[model samples]
Target chain A: MSGTESPAVAVRRGRPRDAARDRALLAATLAVLAESGYGGLTTAAVAARAGVSTATLYRRWSSKEALVLAASAAFAADLEQRPDTGTLEGDLRILLRDKAAGLTGESGRLMRALIGEAAHNVALAEALTAALIDPVRDRVAEAVRRAVARGEIAPLPDVDLVADLVIGPMVSRFLLTAHPSDTQDTQDARGTADRLLPFVLRAVGGQDASGDGGFA
Target chain B: MSGTESPAVAVRRGRPRDAARDRALLAATLAVLAESGYGGLTTAAVAARAGVSTATLYRRWSSKEALVLAASAAFAADLEQRPDTGTLEGDLRILLRDKAAGLTGESGRLMRALIGEAAHNVALAEALTAALIDPVRDRVAEAVRRAVARGEIAPLPDVDLVADLVIGPMVSRFLLTAHPSDTQDTQDARGTADRLLPFVLRAVGGQDASGDGGFA
Candidate 1:
């Protein structure tokens, strides 16, 4: 997801880092992010929660921002598990469901807190988007691309629009509306896709672009 | 704009409100919003900035929140001005350009602040979305709808997706990106649209959805 791979991140050879401790620190960081927000999260509290020395915490992450980024990276890795339902629509249905589930979890709260951070902290926001939003988006786009290749559906009118259509309203439903996380997710995703289908069909105008079956 | 009108708006009997004073007050309100954020804006400062009295401001808007809503209303009104460029792609180009321009202005900054407010303040966010985002979206949707009616585009796969595709990246660009204002708007909007065109065209699935037109 780092658009540019700047080679392997080489750390100076030293005593082996504690992988378990690192994981614990990330959990504490995420907990703090949800409870206190980025501004309020304290390194001492994170260290206390992770059961590591404050110096150790600082040694691992230079600042609270770095700590948050580390926490976010861990969340990003966990969030990577998308449901592969085979069909583009099927895979999306499952993937979006999983995403909505994640949104209301610790990750969702961290994401909300991180969004607030974006207003003032450039690097943090960029890290959050790159580490979080873009990777999943690419996967969705690839699934749609495959659908087109298989003639399962028409080519998209505008794939970017299609992706946005797929991604946008789910966000709007969550961020803008007061829809409960679990209760309204199904309707939100379906409704958004239903709305997007017509536009997608139009953007792919060609012999194969015409509707093949009754739209779901 | 009122998908469903509020019951709270009291009966009104007015000769004519001062157009000049109202305009001045709105302008002052926007200034206050930008300087101190939505939370920092106040009736007193808005009045003083407009060279009016707090009583005069209260006569028009009951509270700070109400005043902000009124300010947002003015921006929303401008958002409804439809651009009929005879084709869907062409109209989108204009709408997206204006959306970029709108974001470049005070309204955009104010919007970011208010959307942040929405995250914390439920009622205000609902009002902002209803008063602002939804209306503009409906108009744009209508424009896309008209394009479909004219055979200039194919059927909308999901109208909501069409809207999202049209607005999502723009929203992502504005809210997520760290850029100051819409400096890279033209390139961003055009580039995003260009990339998504293939998928979007396929989604539309039209004979002539292979677009060959301009928004103008």
Candidate 2:
């Protein structure tokens, strides 16, 4: 319910899949994704890049979509899906920082391709919706709900939109602008989350959800 | 220099170019953009749709890129590009509302294609940059700067990023999700703009830029 990664049961009684080769395959996905881009990703290229056979790759994933989906899911391992520091502000800052760290080379580029390609490919869109996007939405909503229950936010206006506003800039950066080494984007996301927290707290008005300014 | 649309120099002479036909050509461009999206858009299609010859269409627009750019320019006719409402809030609201109004049909599709294609299309991107994107960015930046001069915001941290955060959601929405209606999309954009303005103002630190519980 909390951490990311889809369920994939290992084959029931085969030669116990090679964990090392699996890592290479995932690494190969990122490699091919970075080297060529979405248009250039292919099973043969991925297998070759990973130094594994096509049959080995096929055993794990039936299609390129499935392979990319699994690899993208693996990328989430680097992300802390919902780290709760007991206070929203602290949790958010850490969350943002971790995401900033995750913005290294291939991961960001792969994310861009996934998002951009989703517009045209219905299957990828659906896969993305269930696997990545919705999970994020649900997680943000959960934090808001916790805030509401604890009487932090006023609980009046739509929580979903509030969550979008909180996280939307991050998505914007992920899609539109080139990644910045400057802390402006980081500070922006942090500040936006903190400022909006008060309004959301007021909206979901209560005694103040722990009254700990999430930013500070 | 101050507007999204730069006035082209008069070619001076030659039958004034059939007013009715010009109107029809632009209308046809919109229809084609709406129906075919970016990749499918063509001058040939526009010519056929408008009942104009290939020669006539080519005479006015040297290529497909030229036609799309011209049609994009045509879309800017109704916008007053950052009207001086004497207040930052008022100017922003108008700008946001005008952008919202653009979410429907061919204009929406064309704008999406323009940006998406900009990543790959060099000449089209340059033409669009001059004809469309830069002007809007300049006008919005100017409006924010006025807010700064008037002590409406603190002082912009990063002008371009501020521009991105301000307008980013609209672009994201246009490209990312399929909203049900233009009216709803516009309202969502206005709300996002209002919510984000305070943080932007505070970050910029202007006296008049108090957020004042705007997100509600």
Specify the highest-TM-score model's number: 1
lDDT of 2 by residue, A1-117 (tens): 112222343433233445677888998997787566566799999999998778778877898988887877776655536866665455444544444334334455566666545
Kindly give the stretch of ten consecutive residues in candidate 1 chain B with the minimal lDDT sum.
B207-216
**Candidate 1 lDDT by residue in tens digits, B152-211:** 655544565555555555666566555544244555655665555444334444222443
How accurate locally, in lDDT, is each candidate?
Answer: 0.63, 0.57
By DockQ, the best candidate is 1
Model 1 lDDT tens row, A154-208 = 5544454444545554565555554323334544545444444344333433222
Q: Candidate 1: which docking quality band? A: acceptable
Q: Tell me how candidate 2 scores on lDDT.
A: 0.57
| Chain B TM-score of every predicted model | 0.77, 0.75
Worst 10 residues of 1 chain A by lDDT: A1-10
